[model samples]
Target: MINIWAIGMVIALIVTTIIVSIMGKRATANTADFYLAGRKVGFFTNASAICGDYFSAASFLGVAAAVYASGLDGAWFAAGFGAAFVPVVLFMASPIRRFGEYTIPDFLFARYGQSHRARIIGVVMVQLISIFYLAPQMVGAGTTWNVLVGQGLFGLSPYATGVWVVVLIMTLYVALGGMKGTTWNQLIQFWVLFTAMILVVIMGIVNGVGYSDSVAKNSEKPLLNPGKVTVAKLMEGEPGKRLYDVNQKNMTPEAFAKVQAVVDKGDPTAEVNILVPQKNKLHPERAMMFNEPGHRYSALDQFSMVLALVLGTAGLPHVMNRYYTNPSGKSARFTTVWVLGFVALFYMMSQYVGAIARQIIPPEVAKDPELMKLTVDGLLLKADQVMPVMGKIFAGEFGLGYVAAGAFAAMFSTIGGLLMASAASWGHDIYENYVNPHAEEWKRVLVGKIAVVGMATLSLLVGLGIPAAGLDKAYPALIAMMVTWAFSVSASAFVPTLLASIWWKKTTEKGALAGMFSGGFGAIFFIVMNILKETKAVAPDSFFATLGTLTFPVLITVPLSFAVIFIVSITDKKLPANVEQIWMRIHGTAAERRERRMQQMVLQPEQK
Candidate 1:
């Protein structure tokens, strides 16, 4: 069975690639060009590209899915994601660009002076976050592949094929065009995603009205509740179990007693249904009873997508980086405003489409072989697949093709930006500056290109390996968790380094190193501990009760780093003596520099 939908998507991707390649040639090939597109990006263009690169699989598919899954609480993820950028804009963005470094590590090292200790730890944070981030993209690739090609095309597993294909395409694009190609691709893809989303929203509203009217006339709750529900996954383990093989079966005796008590309290003679695996007496094979008809449907009409557009665009990294490509800091700020307007229009449309999917896709359809299994024994279905599933429903074969193509483009654009950013850190901050200071410009650029290819390949392998290793198919959740770690690391390390570089004169190399290390390492430690406790690797019997919450713990670490850095720097008392000169360069007026440059340009032209 040749799926016309899959074929259409392939065609769309090819068209997007050709168009971006043509425009990308406009960017000159040099270190500056490779890294920052020679700092000449205009406002509208960069802003659009930012929106494209920023949206990712999470924002496009994930947000819609989350809204559908959690009812009201899932909205918090989108809100947190978007609002995170406000602090970045007010505090980090302008100063970071002004500091004139390639990676977060580069900025830190530059501000703190060369310390091997800081470099090693910074690399660790980067690798951890990037690897974790890469896993989700890979998992998403598998997911989309499964939906589009798996069932329709061949007997091969959709999950395996999807991961490889998504990684393969992203690798090729990043390897070939570098940053210039990546930016152009992102800019175009952003528009496609936005357009698709708009169509979805419009159709959704129309669907909502029809569903709502039908329910109102019939005195029913059709649109109000999709009526699907399932049990949430609970961590399980036993004493003496290894970390990796802590079987989901094998709950402790105490846990069994607790469950029996609950069962007895309900009714002494009532027959209790438990799906337990044969070996584990306490733990069950399938714990929760599922109900497909009772899951809550979305109240899409009530959401404010307009507010989301504003904050969401601001928080994206790929979008923030685009401003650095602009000629001046002022141009970068202007580009952000442009992004706000463009993204707002597009996001509203996407939201509408997601809403439409909720209205049209029937509750019973989830159990159908071809449709999403939204309710699994009392547990809600994953929300991330809503947009893609909707595409299959409304537009039928054609819509599926369009949505998949757009999604692939979206992934490519964002992944390429990340690869390039990561590569720069390795090449410029680690290799060239620290390992080989005398390296030629051409060699440096070549090294970066090679590093980009290497990173992409490694990420591909890692992404594919994640599910194979039996970490569970919680790919989206894991990826989201890892990105938060990245954000936390950046928030802690970069926040201090940035402030010190631009504002504080007393910041010493020792203090910068301490802050970066402590903040980065401390967060990792806390997250790992929480995860272990959840899995019952650290404690078996009372897993949830044993695991301490992380939010307050994370807050404690940030200040600890800040304090360490400040104290260490003062004690060392050997700070950068020319700190004032460095500050002048970073914080100096652009008008003053431009005025001097204009005078020179005029004088040189007359002399020639």
Candidate 2:
């Protein structure tokens, strides 16, 4: 059970952390340095770091698991993730950097004419998104640890140990190095993930599992459809008990007639009546193709997911915070270009990895009939376990360690960024602005470090309860499903408000507040309803079901938020008189701002 290679990987990670800590210590002399890295990061470095921060366990493992389980639908998840950067580069990057603020809340306060209401709302949304986002990373950490170590320390479960280890490591890194250290660590983690994926793909090819052949083999069989329901009779003593013939709902008229004929001639004393698939012929003649839709989503769900991902990237605090580290607007724009390139390549490789995993690992039930009890439907016992299983299949024990190390790297980089973002919001936005307005620079840094520890501890406790909550089994790919909720909330709450603030001068403080509350609470409400329905606490045919069926809430919440803001802003007669000045500062070029500052300096001397 002991993995020597895994121990080596952990040692390597520790050594890298020490080196980055040393470098970060040199720069952590003040609040500005700790939070923004002195605003001196260049384009390529910042892009790489952003990739690390953005590609969480959701991207690294969940994408592969999704493809393995859902085929083309899973691939679309990766496509949406890669395509999200388009909107970020086209609309948000340069303008956000030009605003020149440390955090999103700072921008909100300034844009709304220094409104405390705007700042408080910004803090609430940021914390909500960050905390929700952090949970998946911790889940990923626990999953990887369960696979890699397969043992618990003392009385702790493997899952709990994994959560604690990752939380502790990330807390130390963020607390010591701040933004500068986290960025450097992220840069290194991204390459490690990229390289491991490439190696897996190469090994698969060398082992004679060509991409075309794997796709062909997988496409030959019918994809599993969870939505098609069938009816069966219950026994006398067993109330509400039913048996499911997964293929019965999808059968053609001819197939159904043949099945009915057999059922009609069979034993009449059977307790349950259902038509099952022929034991010898598991593959259906009419099956789903890899290029077709409806494998995992309806037309509405597909559009909703794509919309959330595309708009959500623009609103994520951890990703947007990286832009604030850039020296100028131009650097932020260039960094976005690099991020798109790197992320596209990563996603392309991940889809292929999923295909390869499916080809190499035969379902456990096929190998041992007894294992079916532990499996969902005799395919993958656990979808998240596919990556590590494939690693062991293609490269033995050492390969499992290498791939698991990459998985841990993915979690660490993402969690570090999330913790740093939370710290900035709590320490700078809330504590500094509200608690002690006259606090020194060193005191602010200490507060930020403390915030990082507090947030990490909270995330760890939440992660420890995830398995018991049955989240791991409810969704096909647990990390991706949870992450989609985070994205939906972020896109609905932040994207519309931020866009209006930048482009529409009529956006009043009251309008912004209404939009934020409507968008944030609306998404949360629907998400809770969905959970309730899933747990059977609410009836599927009830009113809550209508709101909960749609996995991505952005389709409803985003437009609703926009409408409220627009209506409220137009109705309110009060407007900030210096709106034009704030607009110029946000939209103006660097040269124009420099000239205005020089004029102010000269006029100040004359007035004195």
Candidate 3:
């Protein structure tokens, strides 16, 4: 019963991570090296690291899981994720690198009048996005551990055990290795996930699963989901026309008997799990189809979802912070280009992997006893599990090991970046500047390491708390869904203000503040309301209930944030005195020219 392959994979990952951290710790002696890899990462290496940072458990497990659950609607997660970098390349990348700072907060605070208030706000926004983004990766850690270990260590649940274990691993690596270490680990991790995905796709094709044909066939039937409904809910309506009757027609005798037993117990609250037909919110007149729109999102939500994702990539503090690590502004732009190709290919293969899961999973689930535990009448009980389950079906426990390792890699890589960003925002941006401006270099680096631990601990608690809050049960693909919320917040709060700072010289601190609060908090309000409604905590007739119904609020928040910035900036007209100089720093290549000259001098042969 012991999964030696899975355990071996985890051990290998742990050992490699520890070794890298030790080496990186030796190399890291100052704040610059700790926070931004001493601003020495090359274009391609930075791109690979960015890919690893950007593709969280959300991409590795959730994208495929979303596709498996919601059909065509889920495919948009990949499209939106890939398209996000285009705006980054065209708009934000050059400015972010050219401005030349260790973190996004540093750049924003410096750009907007050098106010302490602005720095504090930037720190809050960084925490909001990083924590939101960090939680799902932790969820992935717990879920992967559940599958690998099948039991908990000590007296804790398997999920809690996973959260504690993974957090320790991440804290040790990021704290000790710093950006220099994580960058190298991220580069290696990206390839591991990419290879795992490619192998799944190629192996599926070789196993005689026709990609397009299978999807076409899948679309022919209404999508079915595993559902758990109480006896009272299932028994509603007329006899033979109730939810129970509809469910019974598709259920096996063994499954039906279990349901009947629950009903016969006379407990209205007793629940039974069965396959249920999915409804299309976009088109209520039509049945949900695998190839058509509207299983996870409504008509308006489709646009909002895409908007958040595309704009959000440019706004992510952790991802944007990486631009500062680039050797040059031009190299930063080139990094975005490489990121586009790398992520696009990974998502394409992920979609293929998801599509093939539908063909491969159901047929194999009934035969494998271990696999049966993950399914309900052969359909996956949780969509986030699609990749690993498919991996096992293809190549047994060894395949599970491969995919599970990839899942952890995805989580560890992203969490490491988030921790670095969080640390820089706190230790570098807040502690070094305001709390202890005159602190020694060693003290500054020590603070960063401490911040890493603090953030990791916070993330662990959030991970453990998610299940207790029932947030994990509120969505079909919670990993992908939760990450989108983070994207929505980043897009609405940061993107407009960031754009104005770079292009609009008239942007006052007040205007930036207005935009940040209006967009950032607005997104948060809607997200919290949505979660409330989803968990059935909000009254159906309440005003908040209406707001909560939206799956994505970016359509309202993004434009509103931009509009607030424009109006406030025009009225305030309190630009920084050195506005022209700041603008030049963003667009000019003086830094690049100086660096080029220095490099040329270094390259010149010494006269003997």
Candidate 4:
């Protein structure tokens, strides 16, 4: 009953984390060391850490799950996630590194003529985005825990137990080790998870699961989703048939018989979980097939979701913060390039893993009682469980152990970075600058540690509350869906203004403030309303109904923020007096050029 191999692997991971934290602890002596790892992380090391940080619960579990559950439409998550970094490399990476700031808010303050208003607004947006992003990781922790551990201690459910354990580990290590520890661990974490995924893909091919062949085989049947409907709704339709006919046509005999048994008892309120033909949400007139494109997004949403994923990468505070760790602008650019390649390969293999599970899981689910609870006629109840379940199917306990450890690495690495980012925004950006400008170095570091624990506590509470909010039931893979929402928020809140700040001299502090408020709050409002609509908490008609349908608001919010900043700056026309000087620094003009030349001169003299 106990999985000794799985437990052993987990213990090994924990031991490695502890060892890395101790190493980081010895290295961290000042705020600079704690937050940016002494600003000396190499391109390759930082690149690997960036992959670990970027590949959250959403990337690790959600990408493959999405492919498994929704077919080709789901592959867009990976495509969008990978494409996001391109803009970062072309637009943000070099300029941000050249700007030389500890956080996004720090950049905003200097760019906008040292306005506290801009700094404060930046902090608000950072924390808001971090919270939205962190919540999914918490939910993911619970979701993965349900599959790997399968049970809870004390009075907690399996989900809650997972959240608690992962959150505590993140808080402890991040607080103890700082960025130096986190960077090295992330570098290590990326490879562990990356290697595990490689093994799963290789093993699948060796076991007769070809990528093209597996996809073709799975697409042969009408794509069906296992869902529940009320008996009352099923009993309504036409003179001869009604709504009941639609479901009955798709349900298997065994599933239909179960529904009939409930109907015979005359219970209109009863619910039945039955397989229904998956509808093409994008093109309702088209058929829903596993290899097809219209399974999830509409014509409008396709573009909207793509924009959210692409622009959103530049906006993530935790991710943006990593750019500061680079020693130079060139290093930052190199890191982004490396990250793109690593994530692209990881995503490709993950989709194949999903396809293999699609072909293999159902047959095995019937034979294993433990696997039964995770699936419905071999289809996963929550698609996020695909990786570990597929692991067990592929190689029993040993395979499960490898994938489970990877899942843990994914969650811990990203969550740890988020915890550190939140700490820096609060402790370094706010407390160090405003709360105690004269505080000792020890006091400042202590505040950062305190912030880490506080964020970890908040994440734990969010983990427990996800199911209570009905978010778990509202989406097929909530881990991925929630993460996309966070991306939408960050893109809406940060990217437009950041671009304007670096490129346009007229981007006044007032304009930045107005833009942040409009875009940041607008994204959050749209996401909340959509969630409410999905959970059946709010019923909308006409205009509200159309707005509620938008799952990714970046299509509207990103442009709106850009427009607001442009119009407001034109009207205000109040540029900073030192605007030209700051421009040179940001764009590597005379000021930055002089600095670089002087640095080269000093090095040449030493060499002579």
Best by lDDT: 3
Residue-pair clashes per candidate: 24, 0, 0, 4
User: What lDDT is obtained when candidate 4 is compared to the true structure?
Assistant: 0.86
User: What's the distance in Å from true for residue 175, model 3?
Assistant: 0.8
- Leading candidate by TM-score: 3
TM-score, prediction 2? 0.87
Model 3 over residues 1-608: C-alpha lDDT tens digits?
55788789878987998898888997679888888888999999999999999999999999999989888888999899978899899989998888888777788788976877777888999999999899899899998888888789899998899899989999999999989999999988888888888878888988988769878978877888898898898899999868788768866776677778889999998888877789889889887889998997888888899888889988898899999899888999899999999988998888888887877887787688898888776778889988888878887889889888888889999999999999999899989998999999899999999999999999999999999989877899999999999999999889998998888888899999899989999999999998888887889778888889888889999999999999998998888887766777787788665665576588776632
Q: Name the runs in model 4 displaced over 4 angstroms.
A: 232-268, 540-543, 589-592, 595-608
The weakest ten consecutive residues by lDDT in model 1 span 289-298
Off by over 4 Å in 2: 225-291, 363-378, 598-608
Q: Which of 3 and 4 is ahead in TM-score?
A: 3
Please, what are the lDDT tens digits per residue for candidate 1 over residues 391-433?
Answer: 7666677776777776776677677777777776677667787
Task: Please provide, for model 2 over 463-553, each residue's C-alpha lDDT reduced to its tens digit, 9 standing for 90 to 100.
Answer: 9888877777566687887888888889999999988888888999889889989998898898888776666667889998777777778
Q: Estimate each model's TM-score.
A: 0.74, 0.87, 0.95, 0.94
True lDDT of residue 11, candidate 1: 64
lDDT of 4 by residue, 468-499 (tens): 99988788878888899999999999999999
Local distance difference test scores for all models: 0.56, 0.79, 0.88, 0.86
